[model samples]
Target: MFDSRHIRTFHAVVASGSYSAAARLLGYTQPAITQQMKALERAAGTPLFTRLGRRMQLTEAGESLARHAETILGTLSAAESQLKAYARLRTGRVRLCGFPSANATLVPEALSALAAEHPGVQVELLEGEPPASLRRLERGECDITLAFTYPGLHEEVPDEVVEVRLLEDQLTVLLPTGHALARRRAVHLADLAEERWIAGCPRCRANLLHECAGLGFVPDIRFATDDNLVVQSLVAQGLGVAMMPALVLPSLSLTRVCGRTLEPAARRHISAYVRRDHLRIPATAVVLDMLRQVAANRVGC
Candidate 1:
């Protein structure tokens, strides 16, 4: 195979019109230029240059290689420019997968900030719970994922992926306006042990059970749903009480419903997860930074 460096040197010598001139242009000694030309000719299996008086002229083989060199070098130069643009965040794409609440809250804000700072970097968003989002990431369907987990309640994160804690989202107790516990400054899990319960996504349901079990009673969960509005509506009708993350509370209208922090402070940790190798991707890294910036500052980069 022809070495690109040797081809480059061939062009320099042809363009500069002499071995000594090519050496000076290329920052190499005259002897180095001669050696490179010799190697290039051997690879081509024919002589490339001949002297015509004081001038160097291209032989037939030299003319053929030179004709293709322009296309070759142009392609190489264009590729390098694109790589530079990607590294500088001037152009790139990031696929972001997030759950429902985060899509409503952190994901939008972070994405807005990212677009403002990097207009050329495009982003695609997918909404799903942690398990689905993480699975997509593992399958190379996404570049970054926004997910949350209850401490010690969920399975361990995959070894190939790394988690960045964006914020600690406190779980708030949702109750109907007329519910007896709605007036309390804070509600204890034990206080509502016997009330009918509403559960959310799988992880949240697991957390509720884990905490309730610790309090020595099982909840009579009457409803299950992944939608926040559904959970809120159920609580508003006084059908059940539910626990939700603090991040989602503000966007939801509390009409006929109210929220209180758990007495001992149960929290679902919000995080951005990416494969370890993705940390080197500028677009992904930038998105992670923006998420941490817009989050509650409960944690840092």
Candidate 2:
């Protein structure tokens, strides 16, 4: 059996690139670090490192062991963090990731509540689109991810992730205040067939194209941007019309823009997701609860 201490020592050596540096970092003498490395090699029954002049390089076995060691150490660290969080609920860290609109609106409110409730808990926020955020969550880089899926569109969450639906956000059409369509209660996708459109997000743009195709008209997209503010600005300047989520309106200026719900009532389902196995972590649970509460309050649920 390989001792964790020896493995850790080996990891340190690999990280620092030499036994002497590893010893200094691990609080041991160089000779002791050498002894541990030799013991580790013996346990594996193969040479783990090769000396090239003054530098140490990992052999094939060492490279393999290093990869496994990283995974093992990472899992062990996560377990320790979860255990500590369980023991002391108020004093742990939670990593959260979300898209731009949620980061501007929902995340701020939820994090504010979390901070007020548990001052000792450290919260880290990463901004990303739904797909990237979900990927990060799967990679264990984040504890929770705020994601959305267009209800009737081509979007699906992975089965390994547990999604808790927070609210349904309506997709609204944004037109210049002086535009003819601004007088209508709602605009049909076909009615704006000739109008130049500003599109954002690849999946969202695809959804727009799909919906337009259903109406037998391909929208003439004149501008494309991922930035919601820019999309709103272009629409405000009468450059083009745009489809935006209701959640995004709260963050936009909307001074020269009029927003109306889509005629067919397109909606996106916003939800928070966590790995099934990570749901047991206290910090994750706390943040998830806070997120749900904030979402409910925002949607008046």
Which candidate number would show the highest TM-score if scored against the true structure?
1
- Which stretch of 10 consecutive residues in model 2 shows the poorest summed lDDT? 150-159
TM match of model 1 to true structure: 0.87
**Residue 75 accuracy (lDDT) in model 2:** 85
Local accuracy of candidate 1 as per-residue lDDT tens digits, 106-196: 8888878888998888888888897888888888999888888888856366798988877888888998989888889799989988899
Poorest stretch of ten by lDDT in candidate 1: 292-301
Candidate 2: regions farther than 4 A off: 1-86, 153-159
Note the residue pairs that clash in candidate 2. Answer: none
Model 2 lDDT tens row, 165-274:
89888899989999988999888877889999999888778889988988899999998887888998899899999988988877778789978778887888888988
Runs in model 1 deviating more than 4 A are 296-301
> TM-scores of all models?
0.87, 0.69
Superposed by TM-score, candidate 1 places the C-alpha of residue 27 at a distance from the truth, in angstroms, of: 4.0
